[model samples]
Target: MSGVREPAGAYDPVDALLQRAHRLGADPRNTNYAGGNASAKGTATDPVTGGDVELMWVKGSGGDLGTLTAAGLAVLRLDRLRALAGTYPGVDREDEMVAAFDHCLHGKGWLPGGEGTAPSIDTAMHGLVGAPHVDHLHPDSGIALACAADGEELTRRCFGERVVWVPWRRPGFQLGLDIAAVYEAHPGAIGVVLGGHGITAWGKDSAECERNSLEIIRTAERFLAEQGRPDPFGPLVEGYGPLPAPERRERAAALAPVIRGLASADRPQVGHFTDADAVLDFLAREAHPRLAALGTSCPDHFLRTKVRPLVLDLPPDAPLDEAVARLRELHAAYREDYRAYYERHADAGSPPMRGADPAIVLVPGVGMFSFGKDKQTARVAGEFYVNAVNVMRGAEAVSSYAPIPEAEKFRIEYWELEEAKLRRMPPPKPLATRVALVTGAGSGIGRAIARRLVAEGACVVVADRDADAAEAVAAGLGGPDRALAAVVDVTDEEQIAAAFRAAVRAFGGVDLVVNNAGISVSKPLAETTAADWDTQHAIMARGSFLVSREAARVLAAQGMGGDIVYIASKNGVFAGPNNIAYGAAKADQAHQVRLLAAELGGLGVRVNGVNPDGVVRGSGIFAGGWGAQRAAVYGVPEEKLGEFYAQRTLLKREVLPEHVANAVFALTAGELSHTTGLHIPVDAGVAAAFLR
Candidate 1:
């Protein structure tokens, strides 16, 4: 009820406001990373005169409040802000309103060297509230009430006389004016609920403002608790037998690629699947389809979650192949329905709308999937939709789910201000959104390939028989989101299968597979044992076959074109003394590449191979003590092995692992888009191994 008295120590109002902003923004239940804002009014020494002047410090637009700094707060004079608010008779365009706010910035009030950052759109409202501190947030509890069918009545009942209620209005000059008018009418109110938007609370200081806001949210939470709704997803918990644990995870993994492919038809996207309790509960509800159609709880959510999610019903026992086909059909229908909705609602003067595609996909019996340009954003979008499910359920439990009107959705979704935010993003890399799996990627040529793929913006899976080595390489390339580690023995079928499953779980699916795992035995034909021959072929020949088979299955199911690459050796094409086992197995691997290319070409899968000669440096095979033995067979000093091979090539340069990786990149980078069933030699121009 009273303002928080200044603390006994040295006090800085700006620092105090920033501290509260970070606290509110850190709690997703209170406000998401960039969703909420805070402001404080204080006195500062006038630059022109020796008198004190009033200044308002509001969170700047487009900065994350959780990481707010002094520079992130835009400073403006209170008198100028009020004057700008008085000029807005009813409504104005986004640019015009921004221009007015920019004009009100005090010349010397900003933090030293802090200029150009625009104040939040709520600046005028904060100025008009006549409070020393103001906080605006889209708290889940407050939004649950704001979106209820009987929102106004519920507000009155929940908060009694402590809060005022304002009807939904687009956030800008007009909304600020309405908030000010409502505040004047209810001078005793400490907080105001913006119907279909969020809530705002004001007080004499940062502590009082945050306290009042939390009190309002607490009231809403209590009201929802009393409604007494049982959890709908208790049956889908970990030990449930309806859909066995392994089968549920497998089905979700299979469905992910299909969902990602549909959502990213025009462009590439990454998908994140969530089986959180709230999501599963929403899916299990009987009125889910109708409830999900009601749209997002707030207008700000429209930018990320979209107006509605695409819902699919896949029975637990349904075959994945059939489910994939059904998903494609349903996705087409969703797009058509979205187009119809736009046509029915577009004003006569509006421009042609962008394609209507869903950002979140809801699949019953599996999970919910969200798509974005990358993993972080996909996860964020999914989190927002999960929160939406909670808010919608809370509202429905008390009464009916009432979202903002469709016209409002259109305005916010197509607004130039919102469109500009997306357009400002940097252009994506060539391999952005694509996922790659590199076998034996713990070191040498395989690790080089993984690093190259990640540098090109591809999410990479580093697979090797050494768990620690694989994890080290993956961590070096990028963290868990962009790079995953899998300890897999290429000779084992089960390990290979599990590795691919892990890849699909980490990223939505794999767009490229580099079968680089291999071994070598440099024994003469007469001295080669059956065990040595089997070991060589098991990795180079059989391993490539199995990895390619799994890659084909996943890529074909996605209905998107992909690439498969094999790391062959020049010995396969050029016979070398005492290279019986190694040469024979690599030859088999190269031929398999051709056969797969012929078979998978119709499915939009490209198969290729790279043959490099004597890459002694940074080669795991050479580093494993093979270099000394190979040098002895060649009658050269161990240190001169690289020089011997370099002199043999026409180009006279020593081959390196990175040189092989570049050839692999060329095949997957779309430069050789039309060329498949080809083997590229990366041996610094080895004349004998050249394809003729």
Candidate 2:
């Protein structure tokens, strides 16, 4: 006990840190997504030396605190890490400090895999702190005071001497040293406000540390509220006011793909759209342009949102064509400025520019659009930008909004430590940034196709008439960020339109669409009623046409080639007896695929078909009595229908939902990049259904 001090007896620093992280991350007011880090100092018995050891556990790189686990904590020997300060080469070569972190890692045998976790660039901030518990957070309220012109005076008024003020320093080893020095000098101080950054708080215990962090955040919030400045963002701009909800959504759907194309010009990217009140209010303000041009005050915000946002120059509800043209013009200017920014600050040692495209885009009346390598990243990026909006609000309310200089942002953005972090990431999947919409996805073949697409790294929109089934499928896929559900009756034009809009709202736009919604009517030629034919044709034939038409509109707007796959039936080619209505409807769908492929190929929208022979095992149509009807016609029991269909094929293998799904994925997964207007028979060698 005398040799090394622990935060508490029988304490698991890793577990306590994770618990505190979750508690803080559970609320948006505490920290932005993946922003902030928590650490705890504790004692561990060294398995090899059989001696007492002091260690620190902090959140590792690229992990969300809300979802953090013991595995996400980087474990380090406190003595070895503290020794890093002694050999530190000073500010000019501060990045070398990060590479040295690996040597300080502990947990070889005492803990499970903690040594494998990669510490982030903020590692020094936690290890160098004098307190047993430390929390570095990006709360909006704290950031507001941090960036105000009178920030030091504001801090003094808010926390008195309980919290101190640290000068502006790019986050690195030097910054950590500055904070540690302040903590040691002001022994009574509980936290420090980092100028042009966020806040950091420490305490003798976890509970006190969390409470102190909250105190700083909430106190700042209360102060801002008491300021009672009504026109902080200034009076509303005339043309920038938010549109009604329905009109706003329509406008966003129209613009999402175009915005996504602009953002993905450097590389493929996924997108997220939000009309949240925070984004709407900020965009409608008269001061929006002046402040947005100033960029973000926090490193966490600018890192994800880029140097600044691209704000639309046109009116919120401008004509579609005019809006598109203006966006292209504005985006071009934004890109030029960003390129100049990179050239101005980049050095021989600097890493190549990551991209010139904007991660955050502000639309006057509609909403905000954010892009990233994936859905969750894009969503979180949007959330961080909203946090920036809050910071701007509070700062303007108190005094003025002041951000870190552009040169400083470049240092943080292009730091060697950041480049190494990027290099550590694994390569993306085959369909990394592709978004897919699978119709009839509530069950059967559509469900399987949705699963396959997500497995290949594509975000999915699960569309079905059954609301409950759609929600269940979406939940099973991951969460809303990965797979979203839409209530869609494909036969209805409005519902089909709504489904695609949901796709755009949820994931920017669609790159792949499966027209799988179908209804079957198995009846003899003598008993084939007019209503039966109408119903089948309406769902299978007309529904595909409508869906394809909408897809072509969106894909052309994006100018990005995409795929439309029709899930036809083998019966369409085989002419199975007593299946006139179903076969006719499917035949209509199959030919439509060929026709649309020829029509849409110029837009690079590939159209294909997958014809499956009697997918009875998991077919929604089969569950609706089509299986029993087909069994009666074939003189087989209902349960033996699969065997009967399998025996009919040359391969004598029963077709399945998975088989149909595999065919869909194969056609659209880019392997057959140029092969379109073709039909792939997924009936286990159904020669009758084979394409000529």
Candidate 3:
């Protein structure tokens, strides 16, 4: 609370600078103390080894400004500096800490008594200023202001005409030159703050450097006062308890991109921290002002925090569907506001750069979330925003505050590239985009789904109880180029396990599964023996479950949800004539689909069922016996079986295996990403079972 400063009575300039750095919001925890070296006079470290003569200063590795020391700030030879700069442009480009050291020590221009050690990163600029004393520190207020929108305005207001403003650029000889140019242009200027980066100050005397630094602080304080805004955070309450590991992982992942984007878009020079809760809180509370400010440290980070953060109270593990819906609604409203703002302030030929939507979502328990192009930045932004929010909330105990307009937030949220990444990644080929494993695929419905998936750009694996049939279909479908075949008895667990393993090995992973391997019996419930019931259940109920369970394992590991489409029958959903055991097994399979959907949703896999009315395609038991009986009852000839079934439907259309295949395609294609656990009737509306 006392704030960082020199000891109560000490006149140590370094300590004083550190104190201000703390007040300005730099995290002392991340600083590097005694990490630099300096010299009063010029001399080479290896006296007899070098050829040139000049004075130099350099920073040691692993030390940042917060923890750097005067002793750690190295002073070496200028001749060496120039030699290294010429030989290794990259070294000249590195911050003075690393780049200057390599140049000053290893080159031919070593000066007499000039070598001290590695100097601070600002050493190059020190020579540019030709100053005996120089100060370089990452100030939080400066960073906070620099990372804000239109931060240039704040800089102008704070430094007035006496200071120079350099746009955000990476640190190196180039940055040093830019600072030198500005200093030379404004002869009387004593300080410069890199736009979206940090601040730099130099003076003939240490006191002068200190004076200029304090001037920056005072300028910012005055500017903030003139803005007349209260703290963005409201009354303080206990922070929500930490999120569980799974939920935390989920939230961090979801929020990382947004936070990273905000940082990149607004403040490029600033780095991100790993702490999630702290960042979340900061964004939730204080990010609006920065977003509303003119410039950020970088540009892309806007994608993470958006233009600002969204404050809301959401339960952990809240359904993703509901969460996305809420975000979409908020985004829409934000966009409307942005449109109005842009229209009101339009300048001919120059359109606004971003759209509406807060990049970061501030959930009460979760803190701030920053989004970025990469995960690291996004995670950092998220943590940064959360911490800032906490700071604002703490200040709130002393005053009231308001956030920036919602519309401004949206303009950046819908920024094009940010939105583009979210679009689903297109599959490899239009026809072989997804991978499907069709059990009983050698013929009939299984083959139909496999063929359809293949036609739609998905690779198909024709798995059947008959190896020969499987091999034939596999060959017909371009022979391992488009399809694979596996001999598998659905009722046998060992066979099912082996088939899936082979499928995964053959293909990178599975995208869709068609559990169509089933057996049927026409006996009444009363006459059906336990053995008969077991036979049907083994394939229809138990087999389907076994296959689905395995599929779930694969999907969970891939971290992308997949689809499981079961080829159920109308008998599963409704009471049909004289198929007791078959109907019961089918019913059980349908219910299992629902349960699987519920259980696997978090894992990213969706499960659903497709019920075909009647097909006369395969040579299996149902194909010959059930197909003949249905054909006879419908008064259709055997040769016209397919047509007869189609004509009898309410839609007066035949149910082709292809039609069933189409239904399977839709369910797995992500066209119906929100759908799962329900049966899709390919009977052209014959089942008429109005599901609730």
Note each model's CA RMSD in angstroms.
4.1, 2.2, 18.5
- For lDDT, candidate 2 versus 3, the one ahead is 2
Per-residue CA lDDT of model 2 for 494-557, tens digit only, reads 9988888888888888899999999888889999999999998899899889888888888887
Kindly list the per-residue Cα lDDT of model 3 for residues 1-692, writing each as its tens digit.
11112345645433443344333234422211221122122322344553434444434333444444443435455655544445445533353344345545533322333343444344556555555445554444544455455566656766677767777665456666677678778878877766544466666545566567667655655555566355444223344444665566555445432332232333221112233544444433434334333212322233334444554444545665565556556556655754675665444533344545444545544444444332333444554454334323322322322232334333334433234434534534443335578998988777777777877766678999888989988888776646789888887787876776665444435667889887677765677799988998998899999999877766654444578988888777767666789889988988998999899888777889988777665536456476665556556777688777667678877677788888888887767888888788888767454344
TM-score of decoy 1: 0.89
Deviation (Å) of 22 in candidate 1: 3.0
In model 2, which runs have C-alpha deviations exceeding 4 angstroms? 1-13, 113-116
Candidate 1 lDDT over residue span 484-535, tens digit each: 9999898888888888877776778889999999878888889999999999
Poorest 10 consecutive residues by lDDT, candidate 2? 1-10
Q: Count the backbone clashes (under 3 Å) in each candidate.
A: 0, 0, 117
Best by TM-score: 2
Better of 1 and 3 by TM-score: 1
Per-residue lDDT for 53 in model 2? 84
Model 2 per-residue lDDT at 557: 79
| Candidate 3: stretches off by over 4 Å | 1-433, 617-622, 631-644, 687-692
**Whole-model Cα lDDT per candidate?**
0.82, 0.89, 0.57
